[model samples]
Target: MRRDNVSADTELEYNLRFFTQFIINPARTGAILPSSDKLCEFMTDLAGLGDVSTVIELGSGTGVITEKIMRKKAGSTTFFALEINPAFVDATKRKCPDAVVYQSSAENVMKHLEMHGESGCDRVISSLPWSTFNGETQQLILDSIYDVLKPGGVFLTYAYVLGVVAPASWRFKKKLYAKFDKVETSKIVWSNIPPAFIYICEKASR
Candidate 1:
């Protein structure tokens, strides 16, 4: 079940995990397949990884983004990947051994970070589906993210091109606007399946 090395990703299993998981829980998994290389590139490029001492990744499904982050900025910072799915945590850990993969919810990020003796991170890169959660759950996730982030920290997440039109997606956008000082939306990443856009959010700089 484990790969020989962290870099080795079996093409078949990688595709199945995302597809099957999305079918079972479209809201949580979000994507029909793993995020595309181009999308990952755009997100990480704006992450400001060089300045942060600590960064955590949320909802790391099959470690596509996680792997890309590790590959690009592994030596610059410490990454702790928090995923709710045990299977995903396993795959992410295998793919990104340098990262600390925790099977935990984003709502409990503070507790998990403390349990691991980690500090509030400077950036949070999430792949969680905000449009699926009810208002309360959405607020809870945002609250948790805001609390765990350093005052001037940044938080980033992506949404499908189609989801932007949904009421839930707009509501989520409003939540982001309300909670953060600055929220920057990226141009569409056409290479991704279903196409998508990245939202680069940041708290006010201290």
Candidate 2:
């Protein structure tokens, strides 16, 4: 079918673009391939996108997850994505023509929220490479996430199965437990390359 062909083409293009970005800056781009469909579906489901009002996605890569979020989010939901890589940003925009994909760092989410006349968002779904960031960089973005989310909001992100034993991943896990009122992990998505699991963190209600 035409749609299937388009999807296949998009996947190929994204894989090429993603790999290029990862080679250019491994620390920032992280993965050599964009997330798989199963991974994207699992993340959006965990976010409870149907109920959220304002949603923000960090590190949208080639918009694989961004496309999923767009499909799952409520009709009235205010959604936008932040991606620091210009090539990734462009790819995301091209893949998701109507999405508000901003070429900015994850730490700058607040400015975009302010632009929307919102003090906070109901959900923050991130695809950021936590293991690649230094302690300071991790804390800076985590702090920004905590500050920008409404009380009782959900923050969802994923960690690669292979990276679980890494020290930086452990540090990021501890930080999540310390920052959020509750932290939970999803079952591993074995179909994905290298496999991955989601982290669902909730802020305490006021």
Candidate 3:
């Protein structure tokens, strides 16, 4: 759905179409459909990133938001992007050359961290379509993210309107509540065609 009169770049426009056709439709990639620039900026602000040393983005399609993050990068922040789509991954690497791009799934982020001897990430920004995943896979991904997060690190995810994207049987809300110390949903971005909400979660203290 077209959201704004502001046109996306050629790369971003192509990525949006690719995500809609291959990821959101097939449900294989588990990536959310492309979000409007306004929505992406809103999510970034809600992440409350300050002095973030390492930032990881899951499902970095076409690097639309990845590019924005790189442009806004703080002095010490290093951005890492993990994507399951090979074409999109290659495009992201080329588009956001400053980011460390990984052609892999978010479920494997823990192993990636371990292999790289990385302890924890400061923030995680995700565009994975959690509604397409089963309960177990969703929990697994969330657990993996938690395992590699610094104390009080935040995770940001987007979902279509609450009732529509998140169903009761999906148990996403319940799992999130159980997994994180705090979870909050943002106001709907009505400016977007289909509208969406941002889910921000913070890891609890042990």
Candidate 4:
């Protein structure tokens, strides 16, 4: 029961922080509430993150998914949680001190990894707000992702059900199809505030 209480407290804290951040900058934070544990579970299961050696988490707000990933580690692995929000970065760092919490744009992921003597990631889980970025910005970020992900690596992110027909979301999906040979989607996670689904894109062999 102690563990359950702690989880509830963490969830509450995450929700408060996420709402404040979204109020400060909606485009940066995306949702008003932190991703629901239900969504995190679905994402972790679809990514099979426990099996990967190096994982990169883009836009890891409040470490919701980061917590899920760390809790299910099946092997030794490195994790980097990147976020542009200083508050979210600090909060996530406090919650997940083991991860390299980077307060930088995901576009800089390659440079940051190189600085740490790392080359590529086996899997990347993004919580970024793709529906807010322009096509050029989206391309730049996706290119960076491709550069850092090892061949056969997977890139996963979620889109709110309402975002499915948004112009930016539509374009982002098209970009994923162009870059990845295999793009798969998961069933909607109705438990989340706005309802969301996961996209699992596999990098093709060169």
Candidate 5:
């Protein structure tokens, strides 16, 4: 079935089920997979990606976001998609043959970049469900992203609204306030069943 034909909720459920079964134990890992098209368009629009020359996506499931990034095609910008699940990684590679697909976790993204002699990325977009992650794991991934992002780079992510959706989490809010100079959020995409919010964070100027 074509993506456009599927309802958003159905698509979300299918992708979530795929992640839960093959990628991470939904109960243990706390990874909630968003549909590829929704996440890709959301990240691209949030990042104002027209000027960005390179992007690194964390938890690129089934290469949905990768394909979206490819659609933007700003100059010769390169997209690096990281997926911990082997099956998802292979799927992403097949979908976006131009992308540099890495079968690794977000925590190791910087290491992979270093190995490739890449100093930093222009933007980092993620779909990892932070609410499901333990505090340490969450901090580790965030720190790694900060380490690899270029000065003035942006980090974009999505989260489901639970108790409080505006700020997302106290910890994430604190980190963004302390580390980034600017952090903005967009209105919830009601089109997405259950809805989701997008956070756009920009690194502080040196």
Candidate 6:
């Protein structure tokens, strides 16, 4: 098969896998399809991965965003991913063979960081479904993210346009503003499925 045809077929396979996971566990597998390439590219670009020494990806579903991170990060970058679902973990590993994918929850990011002999990471790009998380779950994960980031670190995550109005999403937004020193939202990427926008946040440089 042609390279483009092969790529299209692989993406279709990933989409089916994502949708199946969502069907199996809607609460954990929040998105029905893998993130669009445009959304992933926009997020990684805004993250400024060129100089970062350490990076972590949270909730790397099927490795769509993870692939972008692998390609964009500097050669010296130390990167790993946290994913709770075993199937998704396997998928991520398959997609990014060199990726260190731990079958762990986002709340345990600190432990993983310690294993790599790092105090904190410079950038955190999350694909977690904040809109599907309950208040407590959201706060717990956010707290983990906040604590694992070094001062002046950047955090990036995106939300679907429709999900932005959800009560859970609103609460997530508020938490980002409250936790970070600066919070910025990007223009919607209409090419993405359901359309989405990114939230760029930075920890204070003390």
- Top candidate when judged by lDDT against the true structure: 2
Off by over 4 Å in 6: 1-6
The TM-score of candidate 3 is 0.84
* Per-residue C-alpha lDDT of model 5 across residues 1-206, encoded as one tens digit per residue: 34643466755665765666545566333344545356558767777777777788888776677677777758577668788878678767766777888888889987887876788888998877676666677788888888888888888887665524443366665665676678888887765544667888887657
- Pick out the ten consecutive residues of candidate 6 with the lowest summed lDDT: 1-10
All candidates: TM-score: 0.90, 0.96, 0.84, 0.93, 0.81, 0.95
**Rank order (by TM-score, best first):** 2, 6, 4, 1, 3, 5
Q: 13-69 in candidate 3: lDDT tens per residue?
A: 665666665643567554344567788788877776557887888988777678767
Q: For model 3, give the 10-residue run with minimal summed lDDT.
A: 1-10
Worst 10 residues of 5 by lDDT: 27-36
For 1-206, candidate 4 gives per-residue lDDT tens digits of 12342476776777788899999999878888888878988898888876788888899888888877877655578777789999999888777777778899999999887876789888889989998999999999999998899989999999999878988899999999998879999999998989999999998877
Query: By TM-score, who's the top model here?
Result: 2
TM-score of 2: 0.96
lDDT of 1: 0.82
Tell me which residue pairs clash in candidate 6. none
Clashes of 3: 0
Cα lDDT computed for each candidate against the true fold: 0.82, 0.91, 0.75, 0.86, 0.72, 0.90
What lDDT is reached at residue 34 by model 6? Answer: 83
Candidate 1 C-alpha lDDT tens digits along 117-147? 7768888999898888888999999999998
Cα-lDDT of candidate 2: 0.91
Can you write out model 6's per-residue Cα lDDT over 124-197, one digit (the tens) per residue? 99989898888899899999999999999999998999888888989999988988899999999998887999
Worst 10 residues of 1 by lDDT: 1-10
Per-candidate RMSD, Å: 3.0, 1.7, 3.5, 1.9, 3.9, 2.0
Off by over 4 Å in 4: 1-10
| Reference-based lDDT, residue 102, model 2 | 91
| Better-scoring candidate (TM-score), 4 or 6 | 6
